[model samples]
Target: MDTTLRHGPFVMQLGSMPVQNILVDKEWNIKQFIEVQSICSLPIELMLPPSWITGKDIDKLLSTEDDRLQICYRQFAHTLRHEEAKRPLLPNGRLHSDTLIDGLHSSKFWLLQALQSSGNPLHTFRRVKGYGDNYAGKGKPLAAAAFRPQIYDYLKYKIASYVDYRKDVQKLFNGEYGRVYDEEDLDYIRRRPIVPERK
Candidate 1:
């Protein structure tokens, strides 16, 4: 409820709002999409309250040091920037408002191909445990059904540790995104104070 931080001309943060209200907000949703991709497949029902999550929930996943969520976001935004460095255009010549997790692997594979073909060394990301055992049909662990997105997280942390992520964030929120945000809004997000982790 603190209105001290300026987001655009207005001051705001992820204060207590209906979880759905925040989730469906195009700007917030697209920010998540550009970062995690298909990692979230929860239905619209689950995306709402009673089972809703908040910035705190997200913060739970990040605890690298003092400023985990901010660092995580920095990494995520930068990773997208790396992808943009390779393929500057979305397939449709427009930025997707909602990038469902579909074709996620194919996208990574091709991006890997493009980078490797261009002389980037074979970057072997560490393997993450699967979320379930649907893929464990041959007596494998149910965990094989899914894998943790630690690779992406680690990559984000590693890269952010080395390079500046604010520029990447600006590029994502300010660059060619289709009307989801303007320079001011992007600037607001970039400059918004990092919320402290709940004790």
Candidate 2:
């Protein structure tokens, strides 16, 4: 859409495509993966389009100035980056692609485990066959059936905020991360207390 913006180059082609076309396709794939992971890794109650918060979303309950919400947002974004950095590596030593279905399954499995260990009752939820099933299911829908609605909304907002922040950073820096936001700001975000007081 915005051809004026600079983008990083990718050498490989999907098939019969030129270098520019491949670059465009790669960029789109990256954005799609980010969006899918943003939705899939979160509780199912928060995965619906109606539950998603975007820059254009207006909500009376979600306030931009809320300190508690801001803390959660920062913590979530920091933790997401941390987890992504530690994703499983391929036999060739390259990090596994986030778009891969097996990788998605592994991510959800560990995510559920972490939630359970933290006293979350997410594991009680039944997993349902989701999109890309193709008669034989490759993955199950990530669900958190009994998770609190208000807390679910809060978590959804944090995820949406992080996704938006990442898109902005990637767009502004031409695929480079950690440049738009200063290192001190990132450190502050990462250093915030993991458990904030609920008020």
By TM-score, who's the top model here?
A: 2
Query: Where does candidate 2 have its weakest 10-residue lDDT segment?
Result: 43-52
Candidate 2 lDDT by residue in tens digits, 27-108: 4552222212111232221111111123222122243333443344445444544665776222333322322223223333
Q: Give the winner by lDDT.
A: 2
Candidate 2: residue 35 Cα off by (Å): 18
- Indicate the TM-score of model 2: 0.18
Off by over 4 Å in 2: 1-58, 62-65, 88-199
**TM-score of each candidate structure, all chains considered together:** 0.17, 0.18
